[model samples]
Target: MHTVVCIKQVPDSAQIRVHPVTNTIMRQGVPAIVNPYDLYALEEALRLKDRYGGRITVLCMGPPQAEAALRKALSFGADDAILLTDRAFAGADTLATSYALAAAIARIREDMPVDLVFAGKQTIDGDTAQVGPGIATRLGLQLLTYVSAVGEVDPENRRIIVQRRAEGGVQVLETALPCLITVLEGLNEMRFATMADMFRAARHPLTVWDREAAGIEDITKIGLKGSPTVVSKVFAPRPRTTRAELIEAQSGQPNDLADTLLAKLFTKHPQLGRQIVRRSS
Candidate 1:
C-alpha cells in the first residue's frame, strides 16, 4: 500500500498576531510548526506504513516556508515529502486548496499509484473542515472524516475499514482503498524521531513545485481567482461591553449568593426567571 499524508505549516495560535491596518497575520516573528492536528494524521499514516510495509509520502500546500513542515514530517519517518507552492496559490480557501492538492495527487499517481490519502480533520487557521472532503469529491475517492481508528486494510481487495466518529457515537464503516480520510485529534501520538531518521530527513531532497511545475495550466483555478469564497473583511473581535459582576457577601455564603442571583435575574427579566424555575422544577 502507498499512503499519502497531507500536512500544513500553521502559525502557532497562541503566537498569532494580526496587523492592525493590513488585517494580515504578522508571521514574521511568530513561531511556525506543523499543524498540531496533522500530527495525528501523520502518525496514523505511519502506523499503517509500519504494518503494511509500504511507502509513506507526506504532502503539503503552502508558501515556500512550508518546506519546513514537510521536512519535519520526514523527521517523523515519512518516506517522501513534496511541497506544492506558488504565488498564485496564496490566500486560497478550502475549495482552491483542494483543487491544487487533488491536481498534485493526480500527478503523484503517474509515478506510483497511491492507495490511501490522509488529512487532518480541520486546519486551525481555516477551521472549515472542507479540504479533505473536497479532495475526495474531486478525485472520486471515498470520503471518511473524523476517523478514530483504522480497523483493517485488505490490500489485495483494495478495501479498508475504519471507526468513524459521529454525533451520537462511533460508526464502524468499511470502504475501499484509494480513499481519503480526515483524522480526529488525539487518536495517535507522534513517534519520536531516531537519529538516523533525522539525518535522512535533513538531507532528503525535497521536490518543490511552482505553478508550472505543479502542472497548473489554468491560472485562475489555482489561486485567489479560482477560490469561490471571499473574505471581504477580517477584524479583531470587539470586546464585550459588560463584564462579569462579582458577588461579595458575608463569609461568601453559597445559599445567599444563589438567592441574590435569582432575585437579580427575576428583577431584570421576569419571564426568563419563570422559565428557568419551571424547567428546574
Candidate 2:
C-alpha cells in the first residue's frame, strides 16, 4: 500500500505574464507554487494512506528551488520526499521528463516497493498532458488517466477499481496493482497542515538526487538533447479592434427589439443574412 505522488513547482498562473518583445512567459520574479492540479492527487493519496495505514512518498523533478514544493508535501503528512534535480534534466520536454521520472521511481523501488503512483492530469505550465502516460509506458505500469475517484483496492487479490472520466459518462475500470493514475481536478479538497506537521516538515531531511543518484544511465535521453518538441514562437493575443454596435427599439418590445437587431445585422452584413436564410430554407 505504498503510494508515490509526483508533484511539480509551477509559476503561479495568476501572476504569469508574457514578455512583450520576446513573446515568452515572464517567469522572472514570479512566485512559484506546487501545481494546483497535483494537490488533488496528493490529497487523494493522503486519503488512501489514512485508510490503509501505509507510507506515502512525494516525488518531484525540477531545479533546486523545487525543494519547497516537496517540503509543502511533507507538511501534508507524506512519509517521505524526494527531489530529483540535475543540470542534465533541464530543458526536458515531456518525453525526457517521463524518462527521468521513471528512472527515479525505479531507483526508489529498490528500497521500498511502490504499489501505486499518482500524478495530476497535467501541469499548468505544460498542458500537453503527456508526461504521466509516458512514465507509465516507460515503466510498464498500468496507465489510468482522468481518474475522478478511486473505488476499491484489493491488495490481497492484487486488483483495484477506479472511476474515470469519459466524454459522455464515467467509466468504472478494474486494473491491476502497480498502476499509474493521473488524477483529475476537483476529486478531493486538500487538507490543512497541522502545526506539528508544519514543524516536522521544517525539520524533515529531504532526499536530493542528481542524475547519477537517480540512476539515469542514458546521457542522451535527458535534458535539451532528449527533447524533441521545440517552441518556435510565443506571442500575446492581438487586441480586438472591432466595436459592438447597438440596436435600439423605440417600443422596447421583444419582437420589435429582435426585428431592429436583425435589420441592423442584415444592413451591416448582407452576405451573413443571405447565408442564414439559405441555412433555414
The 10-residue segment of model 2 with minimum total lDDT is 230-239
> Candidate 1 vs. truth: CA RMSD?
2.3
* TM-score for each predicted model, relative to the true structure: 0.91, 0.89
How far off is model 2, as Cα RMSD? Answer: 3.1
Best by lDDT: 2
Q: How many clashes in candidate 2?
A: 0
Candidate 1 overall lDDT versus native:
0.90
What does candidate 1's lDDT look like per residue over 1-281, in tens digits?
88889998988888887888777778887888898889999999989888889898898998898999998999998888999988899878888899999999888888999999999999887788999999999999999999998888999999899999999999999998899999999898888998988888989999987778777798888688989989888787888989998766686899988888878899888999899999999
Model 1 clash count equals: 0
Give the alpha carbon lDDT tens digit for every residue of 54-110 in model 2.
Answer: 899999999999999999999999989999999999899999899999999999999
